[model samples]
Target: MAATACGTGSGPGGRADGRTERVTSLTALDYYTDTTEHAHWGELLTGCGEKAGVAVEHRSVPAPSLVPTALRQASAGTLPDLLMLDNPDLQQFARSGVLAPLRAYGVRTDGFGAGILSAGTYRGEVYGLAPTVNTLALFYDKRALAEAGVPVPRTWDELRKAARATTRPGRYGLAVDADASFEATFQFLPFLWSNGGDERRLDDPRAVEALGLWTGLVRDGSVSRSVLTWNQADVHEQFLGGRAAMMVNGPWRIPALDAAEDLDWGVVPLPVPRAGDALVTPLGGEVWTVPRNDSEARRRKAAEVLACLNGPASMLALADWHHTVPSRPDVAGRY
Candidate 1:
């Protein structure tokens, strides 16, 4: 067999072969195409792998085909050695046994962010790791707001009023994406969260209340009706084109916004609902994971790599590169 160094004691060095034993070759996936834009994920994963003293080979599977293909591959005994799994898919895989439980690998409550950890846990078993963290926030055009003599809004009612105040014939107060992709959750979930509603209870009165707020904005002309057909990129385009006064998005868009010289914008936490406490939004991001190895020693080494990646400096650097918040409170403050 072709042997290479596995980071833990179970590999080549632990045996007669002078060559380090190779851990299982890793096949990675991201929900992104546009290789130019997505190569960064490969870089980040590789960087972590290098730091952890292992070679992690990556491959990008189309986001749309990811789940079905993963299921098919698992059935064929050809599942990838590692997966960069999304949060929503985590539970189903865990229940079906497509994912191996991660708790024994040292992904426990203390080290990982609870909010993120909970997203991938089912029936008390953690199934995935998060490499990125996200929260919905307000993106406003500083120049436009200044010109309009409007202040940054701290509450939903104030934001609605601001949206109405800023709207003109060719422009809109707020821009939203209602598409079925994850982006739709980004635009609408925070409003639900701010109002103390949730995705799990879409039939709740609060849920209906939240949806009403969205429809009300469109009804009252604060948001453009055309926005129902838009996507995340569309919202960004409108913001950059100066056709929308404000948008709700995660920090991933910060890099693009930073590069747009003509756009003078600032970010703030999402506004609170009139009926509730301050806004609390859904958390999202990626988690790095090593496939469960057949040998116990390889598993130990994989755990070490996880520890290194979650270290303070690496966490901060990854957070900065990804343009998302760090899970660690200490790491977050350094930004």
Candidate 2:
């Protein structure tokens, strides 16, 4: 996506005397609460803000608190000038009239995957864009799998057998986020989708089969009951601590996995129900948006910063740093 000033209208930095005015500062928010992740994003935002001729005030909240905080800010008429939302949550806020369409600020929306573009679009308008995106995959410990004499699984049957073979006293064969949160739903989607289960028809036999797979794993002692309370982060920690031989997680966990000196891990696309079945994973990432606010100038500046953040250089840098795929295909190709 490419964004540039759209018109000569007297907007931010525009003057009545046909001169230019500059917005000096802006506020931005997101859910990057980890110390390293937060600092990385802050640096990117600050750089983008400088390019937009503004200083940015960056803030972060815990993942679960981000939406509620944004809601409170929206209700109080104090939404941050630039807001970052998980793609799944974009529609709710867009429908609530809290986001401005990227088109209104001249953001070129071509060259993106249909799924991600749809994720950022609401009512046929683009409200946000992500620099990079991610999806779930099966991560396994090489040593554990080798010890169990099982190759990486490619289908449900193989996965089940491998899980059973790897099982022992203190370790689980697999781990997944199954808490009563979006993370659980996110983790389950690949199974549901790959099995031909539709969200609209949860009672379908295929959906039932998908759910059965999860329950069967728990009942057979391949997966732990503690999965009921685990989030993705917790699941990753379980894998890192050697309590889990395999995990269903996204690439965001790569940094931590690579940092563990004794760990030798490998990843594969999520297994499918059958050998030829397509594995469908949910799209995962955060989108940057210019929120509706009091000052058009501020909104414009925010848009500028948003544009900078989504530019090719920034996209590649973010993907390299975070182990995510660049959202734009051209950039991803280069990456």
Candidate 3:
């Protein structure tokens, strides 16, 4: 699929139920509190609104508060016209009946990655669609790694060796966010999943091996002890401040990485358990969903806005602005 292959309108608009009245504005909700993302998303949404011929009123909350805030809205029967849910929480909202399945509203989903589809699914129904998605990669400071004669690490042993060999008086060779939060699990997934560890079988030997590998890096002083207090953004800071030769981060940090005029960085797939194994990192992004609305006309209008938002041009625009991949595989090639 390609950008040109994306949809152009709400397919076969039979639901213009003649009662659309005069909705001057519709509300939208998301967790993009960062200024860049907030402004960019507002621009994108406003553009989509214009294309759909509706005035879009945007609202946002911190990511941690989204679900609770949504629940409050749900209780008040006042969910936004268009709601953006982080992929993981899509199932929760769908299961709770706050989210209406997109298929019923004619949103496209046939060309997205399976991981993305899985995240937005609830009991076999697609409840949301993200225009773009992101995942972790091993980001190395090119100059630092080259100076230390460390080529990009490709496997567990190689990464360990490179990390240890590159550590110096003030810098650790590698950095990771080992904070005791969901981010820790997200950051650890590549190691565990790349090693064929199963999420369902947490005590499996493969899981233990991955955990042991991380512990080994810490023991050898190749990974900083401060990792316990860090998050993904913190890892980016370590890489930017020259405190770490390499770190695992997502493409969303590309803008931040581009800020330091002297920072020379390169990215590669996260290292695996063995030379031939594929890296398996967690897929991440927010999905757009139409909340259960009071009227058919409102739902139809919201779906039209959604149709525009997920179209190729919008997806590509968003992906480029944020340094993320378009959710539509066809459109993603443009990135």
Give the best candidate by lDDT: 2
Give each prediction's root-mean-square deviation over alpha carbons. Answer: 4.9, 4.6, 5.2
**Top-TM-score structure, candidate number:** 2
Q: Candidate 3's residue-wise lDDT over 85-120, tens digit each?
A: 878778778988988888887777788878777888
In what order do the candidates fall by lDDT, top score first?
A: 2, 3, 1
CA lDDT of each prediction against the hidden true structure: 0.69, 0.88, 0.82
Candidate 1 residue lDDT tens string, 55-173: 65556665556678777776775665566666777776677675656668665445566787687678987666665588778899887677778888888788888888888888888
| Candidate 3 least-lDDT 10 residues | 1-10
Q: Candidate 2: deviation at residue 216, Å?
A: 0.8
Task: Give the poorly placed runs of model 2, Cα more than 4 Å off.
Answer: 1-22
Deviation of model 2 at 309, angstroms = 0.7
Of the pair 1 and 3, which is ahead by lDDT? 3
Clashes of 2: 1
Q: Residue 19 of model 1: what lDDT?
A: 46
Give the better candidate number (2 or 3) by lDDT: 2
Query: Which is superior by TM-score, 1 or 3?
Result: 3
Q: For residues 156-203, could you state the per-residue lDDT of candidate 2 as single tens digits?
A: 999998888888988999999999988899999999999999988999
Steric clash pairs (candidate 2)? 13-21
